[model samples]
Target: MIARQYLERAGLHFYAANVTLRGGELDLIMRDGETWVFVEVRYRRTSLYGDAAASVSYTKQRRLLHSAAIWLTERGGSFDTTDCRFDVLAITGSQLQWLPNAFAAAE
Candidate 1:
């Protein structure tokens, strides 16, 4: 995918893609040095309602959090120790925007 290539070119190491969990899916999983990044890719042909990133509602963020937790658990990782972040790749028409550390897991 173009998003994956873009991230890789920016120096993030690819770990996984299209990771499916019980509640949601992670479009890309990458590593920036020691940080684990969970990326959500959103695409829109036109911004009739809102941009692609804006489509990720609160409920969707919660689902992504749940899925990320499960993914980490399955890999013997812990949220307490593992440094992780959520990112969003928004694609609208021919424009692409990458938002890193876009959201955080609720405390």
Candidate 2:
């Protein structure tokens, strides 16, 4: 619910992707015109280990990329690197942080 609102406010049209695969589950898959934005929505009431965006470790990025591949292949769309980016919608308490192109798969 919060994730949807954040995306909507950002002026990006999106949909929740339910890719119940083996490893990971992406929170929301968004569309920004020709760009395919894979959003990872995270919330933490208290910052114990790190911020919500920092919680998305390297392993999680791999999982997101893997799920995205599965989604694209299943949808049968031509693969291209146009404006693809990984976004993180971090929520801590009532504060919201939007990190665009947070990290890459190699990270």
Candidate 3:
């Protein structure tokens, strides 16, 4: 919720949330100008396992990519032509970090 609020404050238009298709779930989806953003939200109380951002491994990225593809395909309309990117919002304790274009679609 905090991440969604933060993103809204940053001027992105809300689209969808918890979009689960075939592969995985997208925490949040929003629009930034002409770009579509697929977001991953992560939280960690401590950095014992390299913090929340580091938790998004390559395998996770692949899943996210697959899910995004399915989401777009299912909801064609403008989404088919819109530019899209993956983003990560990580919360470690009280700190919040937003990483734009966190990863690309897996090959």
Q: Which is better, 1 or 3, measured by lDDT? A: 1
Candidate 3 lDDT by residue in tens digits, 1-107: 79999999999999988977876898999999988899999999989778899999989898888888888887773334769999999999888999999987644
RMSD to the hidden true structure, all candidates: 1.0, 2.0, 1.9
Q: Write the per-residue lDDT of candidate 1 for residues 1-107, one digit (tens) a residue.
A: 99999999999999999998897898899999999999999999999889999998988888888999999999898677789999999999888999998999853
Error of 3 at 22 (Å): 1.2
In order, the Cα lDDT scores of the candidates are 0.92, 0.78, 0.88
Clashing pairs in 1: none
TM-score of each: 0.95, 0.85, 0.91
Candidate 3: C-alpha lDDT: 0.88
User: What's model 2's lDDT at 41?
Assistant: 87
lDDT of 3 at 50: 84
Candidate 3 off by > 4 Å? 77-80
Error of 1 at 15 (Å): 0.8
Model 2, runs deviating above 4 Å: 78-83, 105-107
